[model samples]
Target: MTTLRRPEIGSTPEPLDLSFPAMPDRLGEVRRQLREWLSRCGIGADRAYDVVLAVSEACSNSVEHGYRHGGGLVRLSGVVTATQLLIKVTDHGEWKSRDEPSDPRRGRGLQLMAALVSDAVVTSDADGTEVEFRIPLDPRLSS
Candidate 1:
């Protein structure tokens, strides 16, 4: 007899491919959709919570600082590999210097996100800002 392996129900989830118009009021909805998507990707409860928090922080910053014209858009994507979950949030507002710290209290979102996720990166260009974070479920949390 051969033992078969199949994707468990709700275990193998698809990547998230979605975009939203950049509006300060839509931030909460953006985070909600992201949270559900991450949950479906088999991410642990704790990791999913972190993803929600980090993504929300990044998006809020984009809305507040990234877009000066207030009519841009925020692009969000999630790609799950065997070992890690990758989330990319991109905005087409303006290029911010990657080295400067806006403020500890108001700008500390990125700092907290960096500490929560396995990896956090912020890239800025003439087009806009792109923030990426990877959440890894290690043996300690995957149980």
Candidate 2:
């Protein structure tokens, strides 16, 4: 279940947290909602679009491959500050490696996210997989 939070802007950035079941159908709505949030945070259209793509890809990977059986939780937490947009997507399930195939598009989400965000980190352990992205805030870049 996802929590409803009213993210606040102040001297210190207030983080917004949300969680949902690892279901394919829900990823799109969450991604769209996050993109809208980025815009509301004063991010540029291009940047927000890139963010949305990266986040969507990460979330998709979690929902589709994070567990071997049964569903788990996919959590998203974000904080928008005057100088940066920090976002994290975490899944509380076993991480499984994707088998290689002929198609190049099957396993390029991490690469794309690294290209889009200023800084990103992906870690997986026995507990879960966590992907964090930090995008530098540029005031004049917003549309």
- Give the C-alpha lDDT of model 2: 0.74
Per-residue lDDT of 40-85 in model 1, one digit per residue for the tens?
A: 6656556567678878888887877788566788888987665567
Summed over model 1, clashes come to 0
- Candidate 1 accuracy as TM-score: 0.80
Error of 2 at 126 (Å): 1.6
Q: What root-mean-square deviation over C-alphas does model 2 reach?
A: 6.0
Instruction: Give me the overall lDDT of model 1.
Output: 0.72
Superpose all Cα atoms of candidate 1 onto the true structure and report the RMSD in Å to 1 decimal: 6.4
lDDT of 2 by residue, 48-113 (tens): 778888888888888877855888889998987666777999998876665534366567777887
Model 1 alpha-carbon miss at residue 51, Å: 1.2
